[model samples]
Target: MKVVVQRSKQASVTVEGRVTGEISFGLVVLVGITHEDTIQDVQFLAEKVAHLRIFEDEEGKMNRSLVDVGGEVLSISQFTLYGDCRKGRRPNFMQAAKPDEAKMLYEAFNEALRAKGIKVETGVFGAMMDVKLTNHGPVTLIIESKEN
Candidate 1:
């Protein structure tokens, strides 16, 4: 499991010219699932994301977690995150999980976030989505289960 977390002032996902999911004052997550990912990976990533202290506090210090700020989450399934580009111009997605398994893990990850009392929105899995966001502080971080 891998996730690219971005702090966003606002974010939205559109599919076929229709808005599917949107949120404000929260984190935008681009999630990727590999063949080895399981519910345990989902649980760990969700917990880490919720408690990550990237949000700034009153003193302008990045000391507040998303839970403390009462922020929302916009989770997007992005199999492309696993694209391996070391060989050629075209990226290879062999590391990305098959759609069936990826979809299950993606849904479970979002559900895990919602269970933490956070308002979680999500993009349609396997859909071609257009995501828009105003990145707060342009703060971004990558989290991977193997690194934990």
Candidate 2:
């Protein structure tokens, strides 16, 4: 599992002119799953994102976690995160998990976040989506279960 986490002031995802998910003062998490991913990967990433201390505290230090800030999550299924571009100009998605398996792990990740007491929103899996966000502090991080 690979996740691109961005702190957003506000964010929304639109699928076919309809908004699927939206959030304010939270994180927009782009999630990618590989064939090797399992429930363990899902569990690790969800807990990490929930507790990441990317938000600022009263002293203007980045000391607050999503749980402390009462932030939400806009989770999007993003197989493109696994795009391998080491060869030629074309990116290969062979590392991305098949849709059926990816979807199950994706849902499980979201459930894990909810279990940690964070409100979560999501984009339509396998749908063409347009995501918009105002990145707070423009803070972004890429987390991978393979590294954990």
Q: Kindly give the stretch of ten consecutive residues in candidate 2 with the minimal lDDT sum.
A: 139-148
Could you tell me the C-alpha RMSD of candidate 2 in Å? 1.0
* Local distance difference test values of all predictions, in order: 0.96, 0.97
Off by over 4 Å in 1: none
lDDT of 2 at 49: 99
The number of clashing residue pairs in each candidate reads 0, 0
Measured with C-alpha atoms, the lDDT of residue 102 in candidate 2 is 99
**Pairs with steric clashes in candidate 2:** none
lDDT of 1 by residue, 83-143 (tens): 9999989999999999999999999999999999999998899999999999999899999
